[model samples]
Target: MKRLKTLASAVVAGTLALALAACGGNGATTETTDEGSSTAEAATGSTYKIGVLQLTEHAALDASNEGFVAALDDAGIDYEIDQQNAQNDQSACQTIASKLVNDGDDLILTIGTPAAQAVASATSDIPIIGTAITDFAESGLVADNEAPGGNVTGSSDLTPVADQIDLLQQLVPDAKTVGLLYCTAESNSEVQIAMAEEALDEAGIAHERYTVSSSNEIQQVVESMVGKVDAVYAPTDNTIAAGMATVSMVANENDLPVIVGCDTMVEDGGLASYSINYYDLGYKAGEMAVEILTEGADPAEMPIEYLAAEDCQLIANQATADEVGIDISGLEDAEIV
Candidate 1:
């Protein structure tokens, strides 16, 4: 980890130097404004410089960012932000994480499992608050969720797997087999899968697991599962969330109902989900950051937090249900997206 951090620092330093050099000559000059102030006045007198590294572009991840920023604003916390999206590239995430560490931000906010992992690898001293991540221990982000013995602690978006499995069963009572789709590279996904498998086993439901290494293979792999399973179960898998349109296209063509891990996934054409509101989850993480930044709370001793069961929402796509010939009328309590 130390060697990797050293390499990341070198890469980011070179990249930042080239970036600065490219913008060196812009023919700009500073001048006094009508208010007797320099033209170089900042937008705000922010005392804090917060660095945000988002793993990829997707609805749930985007909501997490929105909520985090909104929370800071609501708290009247003055901050300068340097936010960057990795576009689902691990190397890009590493570069951004290293750059943030080198820039010496007051605190770092990482979205998604990979981004958190990248930031955790970059610095051990800088405080990190991660959102939209599941199973921090499984991802090796900390020694344990309770009493995380390191400079990391944040809210988890771990949907109750057994409850989600029960929802899957309720949605498709006749399903003899379910397809579990996720990214094989994500430890977060693996953690959820293990829990789901246990639930399926106890319920006597047969399931076939499928893995994808990247978004490029999602459509092909999903197409391959066409005739094999009655329905699909996708945990808050980032790769699948980024490629929901493709998954929807294939599943809809075959009239398969897909139960996902979050409300955004349902909005993106998934059949239904019993999951947490990612925006709320992110808000909680932002509050945690405030505690660390303002109250001088030690992240090394802060136990990881989670949303209550009542906080987990039931969201369903009514149009997808109609297209897939599933009866969601029984789920009247669920929020129709």
Candidate 2:
């Protein structure tokens, strides 16, 4: 009877152990299923959201956004674009960036320096790409120009300032003193100014720096430099670019030749400009974004790139040139639009 009781007790213990083992196995299987389900949800092919924070409404920046969207569409990436224009307001830009981060955007595209800086401060995980920025280093995006060892990488719209100075020399050979006019707050303007100053030093040309902090002060500063310098050089500064009409009027009235950092300024009545096509730079940025999205590439690993454009065109406005009493007949290949 005692032996029977012992056997029964052994059987009961063995059954309970089996039951516990079964429960453990079931729990493991369920946990694995839940994890798999979570992963599946994470990998689900859903629409990606991209936030574009543009500083202002300008032709170049607008074109950049257009190019970026076109490239994403070409890649068949279903994405929703949320565009916000800061209108050159830094605080507004910060708000827009914060909202985009809080809203969980997969990527962020910044058009200008302030916008880029705002986005960088807002999030570290979301990939940020910038276009139309002159110098990434000057803009505080990276430590140096060679490698942007961070979460930001994009194209720079840096016009070759040395070549531009050489072009100016070709256009006005007798020009001894050149006036450099730009906005002090714009880092892009500073980058161009630094390059121009160095090139002028190399060329043995004397230059006067006239910087204005806003568009309202442009006309006065430029007017002051009119007769003091033989020629003027204006960079791709948003403030000055927006107020080109005033600069052109003053320059034409004083019969002073003006060389600009961008072809768009040339179109706006400046004498000549040599710079990369803004649209091409935008397209390159778009390409970089695609690489990051598709190839699992990190923005930090991508090197900052500059668009290569050859042959600076001598764009002479006939009316402006005639007004300035400057005549050049040697070059038929020059664009006189």
Q: Which candidate wins on lDDT? A: 1
Off by over 4 Å in 1: 1-46
lDDT of 2 at 125: 88
lDDT of all predictions: 0.77, 0.72
Model 2 per-residue lDDT tens digits across residues 88-183: 766777778898899898888888877888899999889999998876765678765567888898887766676677777877889999999987
User: Model 1 lDDT vs. the true structure?
Assistant: 0.77
List clash counts for every candidate, in order.
Answer: 0, 0
Query: What TM-score, over all chains together, does every model reach?
Result: 0.86, 0.83
Q: Which stretches of candidate 2 lie over 4 Å from their true place?
A: 1-44, 311-314
lDDT of 1 by residue, 153-213 (tens): 8888877667777888888999899899988877777767777777788889999999888
- The candidate maximizing TM-score is 1
Error of 2 at 47 (Å): 1.6
